[model samples]
Target: MTLRHHFTRLICAFAVSACLSQVPAFAARQPGPEQDAAQQLALQAQRAQMLSRYQAERAACMHRFFVNACLDASHKQERSALAPIDVDLQAIALRARMRAAEAEMRQVQANIAAAQTGQHDSAQAERQSAARATALAQREEQAAARARQAAAGASKVAAPPPVRPETAPPAPRLFPAPAPQPAPQPALNPAQRAAQAAQAQADYAA
Candidate 1:
């Protein structure tokens, strides 16, 4: 009977302990939004740090493996001697995932650069076209001004009246009028006769 009583007390104590354990000891300490955010931030920070470490490792591994392999392609033995990183497994797999991420980033950067180049080229082409159009319009205006000047000049030059040479006045004779002749010298004064002879000589010369 004493043994049975001890066993019953033990059972009661165990049952009370179990019920107490079911109740929360720190019901007032429920997690809040701030605490959850802090916890998430800490977890993300840890993951980022780990990712950086992995990146460094991957870079080193790539430098030791693929970089030299590509550079030494002509040297078959050197290429063969260098072992493959076997990046399909283990820590190498993690490196590969990082490389994939880097490749994606690089692709995005390249796309941006290409788009910028295209925009610049299009802008340049538009400017050139505008300049050409302006120059052509100016040239056309200048040519029009020159044509107007030429037309005005042509209109100012008057045509001469038709020549009437066939009905022109007859030309006048060039000879001079004859003067009155002195009476012929008849065996008279010698001075008068000599003067008359000299005048006759001059008239014959003329």
Candidate 2:
């Protein structure tokens, strides 16, 4: 190459290398979504600046006597400058995809936990409802028994008392009478007594 071509090639290589070196390295810690987006924007801006510089160099190379040789040198420098920026962009895209996958997994777990809780609550409610129904049935049975007892008592009170048959009075008892005795003779006076005595003696002698 001529002295002038050598000078031009050296200047272009140095400028491209210096510009690419100005791009900052990624931090050790993983970046958040906003940080990733900012990094991508900054890298893209640097890439655009690098391309613009290469285009200007290419235009200058076209006017040279060794156009092929100048163009080849410029293309090599452009590739070297763009290589690091492309690597950083790829890393950012990969991290973003990982973050999205993790978020989706957490959401799925939350949905499963919510469904389990709903099932448990539904079972508890059903148990409470069944217990209430049992209590109500028992109360109804007790009321029915009390009503039956009350009806039986009322029936007994409404019934009339048993009646006794009427009977005749007892007849009086009759006894037989005693037999009658003969009447006693009356006593006479003194003369009548003596005549009775004489008549009794004469009758005895005869």
Candidate 3:
């Protein structure tokens, strides 16, 4: 390329750099979908223009004496022109990804909180059940004790009273006591009677 042509290209590059420097920095608030789409469309159009220009320059370079140098210069210009658009596209994509990550994080935190709440409720229910069981057990023990005491009282009431022995005075005598009597003897045999008669006759003779 001629020195004039090179000087002109340098001026164009400087102009593009100046214009890019004047653009506002990335905004604090992320761009909405509509804004992103519009920006992308504009940037794509600019890129297409740059590509078409590069293609024309490439065809022109093929007919020049220093073809490699011409093609290199054209390629460099194309890259320089498209650099800002690429940066804007990257920024937009990065913001979208960061927003997605933040949303996902929030969802995860919500799920964790819900799980903790469920566990707490379950623990509370278990504690209540245990308390009820303890109360019921105490009541049952009291009832059993009362039943035992009642049974004991009933037994005491049903038992017979102890009996006592009594001493009585002798009855008065109805009459005076009688004298003793002798027992009667057996009758004697015939021999004993004859002997007795002879003893009596002898006594008479004497």
Instruction: Predict model 2's lDDT versus the native.
Output: 0.79
TM-score, cand. 3 vs. native = 0.54
RMSD of 2: 18.7
Supply every candidate's count of residue pairs whose N, Cα or C atoms clash at under 3 angstroms. 0, 0, 0
Best by lDDT: 2
Candidate 2, after superposition: displacement of residue 34 in Å?
3.4
Error of 1 at 56 (Å): 41
The local distance difference test score of each candidate is 0.57, 0.79, 0.77
Off by over 4 Å in 2: 1-28, 64-72, 163-206
Provide the TM-score for each candidate, comma-separated.
0.34, 0.59, 0.54
- Candidate 3 Cα errors over 4 Å, as ranges: 1-27, 41-49, 146-206
Candidate 2 has a TM-score of 0.59
Tens digit of per-residue lDDT, candidate 3, span 57-163: 99999999999999999999889988988888876665555555555555555566676798999999999999999999999999999999999999999999878
RMSD of each: 32.3, 18.7, 17.4
Backbone clashes counted, model 3: 0
Q: After aligning candidate 2 to the native by TM-score, how far in Å is the CA of 174 from where it should be?
A: 11
